[model samples]
Target: MRPATDLAAGRPAAPAPGPDLPLDGLLRRAAAVAPDRVAIRTPLGDTSYADLDAEVDTAAGALTAAVGRTGAVVGVVASLDVPFVVAYYGAVRAGHPVAVVNPLMGDDALVHALGTAEVAAVVAPPRVAERLELLRPRLPKLGGVITAERLPTGLLPPGERGPAADLDAVACIQFTSGTTGAPKAVRLTHRNLVANAAQIAAVHGLDGDSVTVNHLPLYHPMHLNSAVYAAATQVLCPDSAPTAAVTAANRHRATHLYSLPVRLAALAADPGLGELRLDTVRAVLSGGSALLPAQARALSDQFGVPVVQGYGLAETSPLTHCERPADPRPGSVGRPVPGTDCRVVDVAGRFALPTGERGEIQVRGPQLMAGYLHEDGPATDPDGWFSTGDIGYQEADGHLFLVDRLKDVFKHENWLVSPTEIEQVLIRHPAVLDCAVADHPDPSAGAVAHAFVVLAPDAGPLDGPNGPAAFVNGRLPYYQHIRHLDVVDRIPRSPNGKILRRTLREAAAAAPTDRPPGDPT
Candidate 1:
C-alpha cells in the first residue's frame, strides 16, 4: 500500500454538471443555476458548481489529448477523490468506456475485470502502474496505463466528443454482488440510470430545489445511480453534502436523507435528531440490507419521517421497489416502481403463484443491468425477468416482504435457523453494528449457525474489536446462537458503505475460532 503523498501529483480538478447537458449536463446546469452554490461536499472541502465544472473541462482536455481515439476502454484506479469525478465524466464525454475497479480487490478479481472488459488503457492513481505490474503475465490484453496524478502534457488538435450523450449510451461499468467469489461487473447505461432516476423523481416528486444528505459512498447504486446522479440531473430531486451527516438537517436543511438500515437506526436513536429543522425531509429510505421491522417502526416513530424498506440487487440496476409516501406500509418493500414488473414463483420455477405464497422473488424492468461483464450471461430465462434468489412473499396488497435466501435458510437438528430472524434480534442490541448469519458443519447437529458481527466503532470490544461472541450466547436461543466469532478490527465496506459479506464469509471460514470475544461490557 502507498501513502497519499506517494501517488501522482494533482491535476486540475474536474467540473460539476452543466449546460448543453448531455452525459454530464447536471453539473453544467447547476453551474448556470447555482454557480456559487455548493455542488459537492467531501471530507476534503466543498466544491462550487462552476469551479468543479471547469476542472471537468480540464480533465476532458487532458484525457482527450492522451488517448488519441474514441471508443477506447479506460480503467481508473483511484479512491473516492475529486479526480475520480473528472476522469469518470471526462472519459464518457470524450467517448470512452469507464471501468472502475476497487483498489482493495485481490489479484484474481482485478485481472479478471480488466481482461474480461478488454480495457485498452488505464487512468489510475499514482503507483497504480506498479500495481498493474502483477497483471503483465495474466492480462496480455491490457495496453497503456495513465496516472491521473500526471496530466497529459498538451492539448489535442480539437475533435468533437459527438452529440450530447443519451441516457442509453454507456455511462460506466460498476461491479457488485459477486463478493463470494468473482463479483459481477454490472453495465449501467445512461438510459437505465435516467429511467430509474425518472422513476424515483416521479415517485418522490423531485425537482431542482431538493437537497439530500449523502452519507453513502459514490459506489453503491443508491448513492451513485440514484442519489448523486439523480440529484445532479434534478431528476429525483437531489441534494448531497458529505458533511451534512454531523450537522444534522441543521446545516444543509436537506430535503432528503438517504441511509442504510444501520445508519438510520443510529440516527433515529439519536436524541438530537428531532431538534433539527428536518420538516422538509418527506421520507427516509433504507436499502443494501434488510431493516428489522422494529428498526423500521422505531425510525418512523422517532423522526416523523416514514421509514420505507427498499429491495433490489446490483444485477437489477440497484432499485426496483421502494415505498412511496402516499400509501406507506412500515415493513413492506412497497410496490414496484413504474416500468417494473414483479411476481413470486414456486420452486419448480414455472407457474406464478397466488399473492400469499412465499417463494423466489423475480423482477423485470427497463432499469435492469446490461449484464455481468466477465461471465457469459444475461442472467435471465427466455423472458426478460430475473430471479432475485431471495425467498419472499407478495402480500395481497402487492407489498413484498423478504423471507430468507433460498440457500441461506438452513436446518440445525430439526429446528430451522432463519438468519434474518436472528439478525433482527442481535442487531437490536446496542453494541452490535451489523451481523451476518452463516451455517458451519456440525457433526452432531448436521449444521450450526455462525454469526459474524461488526460492532460500532465507538464501542470497545469485549475482546478487542468485532468481538461478537461473548455477548451473543446469552442473547438468543442455543439453536440459533452463533457458535463461532471473529473480531475484525474493522468491517470491510463498499464505496457505498455496504458490508462486504463475501469478505466476511471468507475470513470467517478461514479461521472459525480465534480469540474468544472475551466478554461484552
Candidate 2:
C-alpha cells in the first residue's frame, strides 16, 4: 500500500470516527436533536423528525415480523415517498440490509436485482407490490411482498433491533445504472453510508438550518441520508416539471436544489425560467450525469446561484466529489471531499498521471463500498484504491474535471476521440437543445464520431450551410470532429439521466451507410 503522503498533496487523510453510528443512527440522532423539526415535507404532508423516527420504529417491527430472521436482505422499491423512507431505514433498523430497487425498472431488471441481492422480503408501493406479486414465481427466495401502505397496519411487537454496533455490516445494496453493461448490486456498509452522509453534508454545507428540495423522480438515499445526518429539512417534489420544483423550493424556502442534468437542461431552456424566482436557493446541484456547461451557465445566470455538478458511482456510497458550494468552478466537479483521495492513472492502470493530464480516475476513500454483491473481496487494490472507470484530470488546486467514460472513448485512426468533447461543442450551437455522441464504425479510421442531437423548439433548419455539423467540426480537431450528425427528437437516457451511449453506439453502427452527414431524420 502506498503511504498516505504519496497521494494528492492537498487531500486530507480519512477522519477517525469517534463513535461510529449504524445507518439508522443518523435518523435517531436527528430526531433526538430536533424532534419537532420538519424532517420531510411532501405535497402529501409534512413529517417531523419525531414522527418519522417513530414511524421507522413501527415499520422496523413489521419488517422484523415479516422476515423473521436477522441479516436478511430486504428489498425496498425506492420511490420518492414517505413510505419508502420509512421502509428503507426500518429494514436497516430491523437487522436487514435494504436492497434499493428502482421503481421504474423493467421486470427483468427488477427480478435480477432482487434475486441477486437474495432479498427475502420487500416493502413497496401498492402498485409496485402488485407488480412484484406477478414476478413472485421468478424470485424464488422472496418470501413476502409487503405494501408500504400496509406497513403501519401490520401490528407486531418489536423484536430486538439490528446490531447497531456493527458498522462494517452491509446496510444497503444499490444497483448500478448499467448504461455500459449489466447492472451489478453494490454492497455498502453502515460505515460507508454514514461516512458519506457526513462527507456530503459537509461539502454541500448542510445543517439544521438548511432546507433541501429533492427534485428527482425517485428518492435517492444520498439526499435522504445526508439530510438526516445534518438534521436538515428535505422537501420531496414529486412533480417532474422544473417550474414546479422551483415553486416547491421557493414555497419551502429551500437552500439547496438537487436535480438531474436532463431536467436542468429543460429548465435552462424553459422560456418560463425568467419568471421563476429562487430567492432562498443557495445552489443548484446537478448529479447522476454531467450537466452541459452551457446549461449550467444559463441556470446560474438567470437564477443568480452557482449551478454546480458532482461525480460519483453507486459503489462509493454515491458521493466522493462535489463542487464546493461557496467557490464552485464552472466546469470542474471540485475536489474530493474530506478524507477522500483522487488520482488519475494511465489507461493501462499501471502508473499515476501528473496533474491536468487526463486518464482513468481512481479514488481511495472511507465511503467506498465493501465490494459488489457476491464478489470475492473488496473492490479495491492492495493499496485501497478503486478504479472509477472514468476519464478525468485534477487541476493543481485539486478541482476534478471529467472528460468522458473510459469505456466510451474510442479511436479515430491513431488518435483517441472523446464523444463528450464533441457533444460539448455541439450543445453550444444555438439550435441544438441537447446532444449525444458515439463512435460509428468506419472502413478506414477504425471509428468516427457520430452525433445525435435534439433541436430547440424554435430551432431553424439545421442542415443549412451553417449547421450543427459545420459548427462543431470547426471547433474540434480533425480526428475529434463529428463525421455524422443526425437530428433526433431526443437523446436516450437512463432513469437517472445518464446518456444511454451503448444504445446510441448501436444505433450509429446500424445507421444506413448512404445517409449524408448533418441530415435531420
| Model 2 ranges off by over 4 Å | 1-19, 153-160, 457-464, 513-521
lDDT agreement with native, every candidate:
0.63, 0.87
Clashes of each: 21, 0
lDDT tens readout by residue for model 1, 1-521: 11121011112212212123344565555567767766565555676667766766666666666666776767776445556666776677676778877776677778888877777777777766788875767888777777776644233345534346766666677766454456667777766665665566555545556666555433333443343334442111122332245365445566666666656666656677556435567777677776667767766776677777678776665677878877778667877777677777775644566766666788877678777765585678787768887788777656788877766667789876677676666666566776766666666776666666677777554544344554555676778767665444566665445556556555555654432333322
* Strongest candidate by TM-score: 2
List the candidates' TM-scores in order. 0.73, 0.94
Worst 10 residues of 2 by lDDT: 1-10
Residue 284 of model 1 has an lDDT of 70
Local lDDT at 345 for model 2: 79
For candidate 2, list the clashing residue pairs, or say none: none
